[model samples]
Target chain A: MGKHVITMLPGEGTGPEICEAVRRIIDHTGVEIVWEYEEIGLDCLDKYGTLLPEKTIKSIAKNKLAIKGPTTTPIGTGHKSANVTLRKMFDLYANVRPAKLIPVLKRPWDKIDILTFRENTEDSYAAIEHMVSDEVAQCLKVITWPGSYRIADFAFKWAKANGRKKIQCVHKANIMKMTDGLFLEAFREAAKKYPEIEYGDIIVDNCSMQLVRNPGQFDCLVLPNLYGDILSDLCAGLVGGLGFAPGANIGDNCAIFEAVHGSAPKYAGMKKVNPSAVLLSGVMMLRWIGENAAADKIENGMNKVLAEGKTLTYDAGGTASTDEYADAIIKAMN
Target chain B: MLTKATTGRAKRPAKPITLVGVDVYIITENGIPAFDDYGAFKIEFVSNRGTKVWPGYVSEDLMLVNWYRCRFMATKAVTDADVDSFLTQLSKKWKWSAAQKLWNYGDEAGFSKAY
Candidate 1:
């Protein structure tokens, strides 16, 4: 097969370690992938004066496919999130996060498979905020026709393709009528076109309760930026947690696969944290590049390691270093 | 003044003039200023992002930012000297970032509706 080039963003902290584990695992698949490394986040601030540099963005723009480790953004400053910046820069409006049970792992709920399509660009996450007065502040919640409809369209199309039976649009339309109402309107319009899929609307608060109470009732959920950012994590809890959560921010031309979890800078250089999230993200990148066989091998191998319960990280209830766990998965590959 | 059009004809028009207004955006976090020093101009209204919030009715739900746009309408015919004096007075109390003059070009309003 021809060699594929992917932009690899090794973010700060344990980002590099997990990225290495993923690189080794991908290499074992024998699929030639050139990881064009790029630097970003807090570490690059002194050198580039910005968390996201032009060169790094150029690499992602050219390669069109990137897998990233979590990058940290300084808190309570004017600096925009590097993660949010990349998504908006690429117009990666559809943030697809799939939460499914890892057959071997023990959790409160079983057989939980939910796909969350979050509208990545608009909404209150746009960071348009100002202190009206010393006591009053405002952050504009923006929802547009094209932005809402496109994400809804993406979710519906993906649901139809993946044989998802039910799709729910979650929002607080009762309160923020115009903004959230437009989101629900877009979902309804998209749902109309896909008559085969059973689509409905739910208030975000109620949706959260239902998700925890009976997650199996839903198959797919499409939501605005803030709600999706929150509920996707809740759904992840239903299966395992951020450790098992694999996220993809996809636009028309470019896509970035990344773990939903933070960099966990405290765990840096320890080889202690679970590599499941990033490695599974790599599997997503593999499948996106049409390397289905390699993707299948990685997923199956990971499942086997989980089922065997011999080589697993501390989070997964076993004693294995990040590399050791990855090695086991690679060895288990058929 | 006459200018030649593409058809090689001199474009002519009737002299057009009307009363105009100006909006001075001041950063209010520093301080609010006295509105009495404007020469031949009166403060019509002040708004935050097009919502009326001063001199009359202010919404309780309206969140205030540090920036306020003060609309000044000319009481009489305005001159550059009048504008200079107003700005000079405003500069002493508040930091004004931008001032946009609302023009009446013939019969059309040259600025956006602040609704």
Candidate 2:
């Protein structure tokens, strides 16, 4: 079979390093992938004055799938979120992240596997901000019936397809009744349609507490956009932090798997940071295109390499550099 | 914030809880026709054990007797009782209310799924 072409938006900072390592690995494996490189992130910020440029979006639309590296989310003010903007513009209604227990990292739980189907676009992260007055600040938390219905339906469908037993509708509806209430109501309706799968709701606050207390109890988490962002990060810490957790922002027509970690500018050009997250994201990319075998090769090899614990990096408590770690896995695979 | 100085002030005192916005008929322990007040039942929780257990709001206290596990109390509370009766009553109020508030708040907290 001829190679399938994929685009690479290797953003600024360690983005380049990780993307470089991933690209090298793809080439080394003799996997049929043609990657097109493009400039984005801080470099885009300095030159184009936009965090996400029109050209980047256009290219991504053409490819329909991409492997992205960490980009600098312009700090301070007046900067658009490169990730959120793409999700909204493309209507990537679901953000799926599966945090598996990579045995290399020691955690309190035996099995910490969970799949989160977060509703993209339309939540606090909508980036719609307005000040009621000088003394007051307000942000819209919009949740339309259709938006909730689609996301909720999408989640249940995903859970049923994946053989997941239950779908947890995480919400703070008790507090943000009107907004989250609509989400919960949608979940109720969706649950009735999919009687095969179980449905449950948890107050957002207690859900967080319970996550730490017993991470295994939860299965599939479906929530509005904003809660997913905060909760997913915290869950990252539990399953080996950002260094290991991989994320994918998926829409109807396109999917972008990227390192959600920020560009550690200070660590730029050092080649010292862990590239596992981005690489694992590449694993996600592979599976996205039905390359389940390649995806398994990378994941199984990674799991074995980490568990061996010899060729380790700082994040996993050893001193191997990004290349060293990737090299170890590549060698181990051979 | 409550301080230790106020410790033991109410010591199981039967302070009446107001059933501010509810009223309903309840069949009493004697099988007599009686109205059980959900609000008053919840307010009297501290002293009278009038727990307003709605659906999914089960709990355990004294550790042995789980506080919120009353399926019979799954019905919404209405006016009547100690504010008049036993702590046990059937209710179908909001799934959360005070007892299950913990779980609802937890959901608001964030995406907890590990996978």
Candidate 3:
């Protein structure tokens, strides 16, 4: 097969180094790939004058596939998040994150596999806020039928394809009946199509408690933006941390694979942060592009490396640098 | 706990304020690009969730929903009868979700630009 040309956005802080490590690891897998580098986030603001350069947007629009390292969104008032902008621009409605138990992280649960499908574009993330009065502030919680149905359908379809059984819609419909109610209603409507898949709904708070109590009970949980944002991390905590979780933003036309964690600025030039998240994200991207054999190889290799615990990054309680850890996985692959 | 003796209020300036335009929000899957003038009111442009998306080379990459806000400005001083007539004609073809009147306090606009 000819080389797959994919747009690579090496984001701010520790993004570039970890992306480089992931690239090296993927290269070792013998999957032919041509990387097209793109810029996004604050680091590129000086040169591009915009967080998301137009060229980068054009590249993603053309390629239809991208792998991004963690990008930093500054706290408080600033530009709108480039990540949010990309998702909205491309209509990447489904944020799929798989947080499964990695055997190495000896948590209490022997088997905890949870797939989170987050509605990427709607809810409070819409950035629709205005001061209704001098004291009272209002943020419009926009939820539409089309947006809800598409994400719910995506979740159900994804679960069915991936051999998952149960799918749950998590929401806070008891309180905000109209907004969250619309979400749950859409999930129910979508659920009717896939009768083979057992579907149900749970309130967000109870779902959180259920997750921490016994995560093994759930297979896949589809949630609105706010709940999913909170629960996806909780799901990550079950496995190990953000380092073990890999995420992807998928739409009808485009898909962007990325690490769910943020870029740790303190570890930028240190070569000390873990590359597992981005590497695993690369594995997901490989599977997405039909390079399943290479994906399996890298995944198995990483699993072996994690199992051995001989060479691991500091986050995993070892002294190995990022390059050394990646090299270990690369060596294990062969 | 400390509390203010009285709540502050904003008072209108002594300068004259007049109605200049109206933003009519319509719910539609595909946005309406142009509409004819109703009496003295002329359709300026249409925006979706505050981003301008019509009357020129607008990128198809914008994520569109059902909400579209259309701005219509008056060539002369618009009265309540003018708004009623325009909406009456507008209702014949399209259904409007909401409408907000634009005002000019002296030289400054009461509302922000669509862009």
Candidate 4:
């Protein structure tokens, strides 16, 4: 097989550190890949006067496959989110985050496995906010049938493709009936096409409650943008925090696998932060590119290292440095 | 314990507000506001395309527009809770695009002349 050319976005702060660790681990997998490095987020903003540089966009556009680290999105209005900008640019409409309990990690829940499919575009993320008056500020919640249908279809097809048994459509249709009602309607229409998969609908609030109570019952969840954003983080907290979460933004042509955690600028140069999220994201990237064997190998190795409760970073309750932790996983692979 | 009597600012009695009416626009399938009567409140009038299209509306092809504005008046003085109940009931039958509360300031009309 020919070498796969993939775009590597080493983002700002601790992004570079984790990306380096993930790159080393991916290299150890012996997969033939040509890495095209690109800059994004805060560092890119400093250099190119744009958070998402044109060169980075072109690189991902040309390659169609990317593995990225966490990029900072300045709070309280400095610049728009680089992540959102990239998603819109690529039309990466499906945001997939899988939360599965690791055997070694001690948590309140066990045997928990859930996949969250979030609509990547449209909804409140459209950033449409204006003041009707000083007292009344309105933000339009836009949900089109086409947008809802495509995301619902993507969730169903993804479930069917991955051999998932059920899909639950989460929405607030009872309240914002027009916007969320249209979403639920689209989900129902899409569910009819896939008769094999068990389809159900739950209000967003109820879905959140149930997810915490008995998450084992849920197989796959499809939600509109806002609910997905909030629920995905909640789900992340179920198994483990964002440190162990890996995310993928997938469209028809382009896919960007990334760590769901923030850049953690405080731990940027210390090499103390955990790289599990980014490394697992790399594992996801490997699977996307048809290197399933390498993906499985790395996943198993990481699991073994975690299971042993040795050679872990400070966050994981061990004294090992980030590089030391990466080495341990690589050693397990051997 | 020191009470509010020691404070310099005097507390005024809370003003009572009541629901007079509501101007609701229900968005339909074709993105046009639907001209439908909400049973709980009296349907004062319905307008489309900046012209009255219901209850003494002129029959014209131009009046067949998607956007609709309906004025619903309460039978008596209703509290904010009553308005909430009205909205909950209205949402069941129609996809409300926009809603504005019609408050009566004694002799003042909260509604616009366009209605």
Candidate achieving the largest lDDT: 3
Candidate 1: TM-score, chain B only: 0.72
- TM-score of model 1, chain A? 0.97
CA RMSD for every model?
A: 17.4, 17.1, 4.6, 12.0
Once model 4 is optimally superposed onto the true structure by TM-score, how far is the C-alpha of residue A73 displaced, in angstroms?
A: 0.8
TM-score of each: 0.75, 0.72, 0.85, 0.75
Write down the lDDT that model 1 would get: 0.81
Candidate 4 CAPRI level:
incorrect
Worst 10 residues of 1 chain A by lDDT: A128-137
Candidate 3 deviates by what RMSD?
Answer: 4.6
Off by over 4 Å in 3: B1-24, B29-32, B35-64, B69-94, B99-115
DockQ of all predictions against the true structure, Cα-based: 0.02, 0.01, 0.16, 0.03
Better-scoring candidate (TM-score), 1 or 2: 1
Candidate 4 runs further than 4 Å off: B1-115
Model 4 Cα shift for residue B55 (angstroms): 46
TM-score of 2: 0.72
Candidate whose TM-score is highest = 3
* lDDT per residue as tens, model 1, B1-115: 5445545844445336454767787777643334774757788776554444565433232223466668888888876667778788878877889776655547754444332
Candidate 1, residue B92: CA error in Å? 29
Model 2 C-alpha lDDT per residue in residues A309-333, reported as the tens digit of each score: 9998787899989889889888876
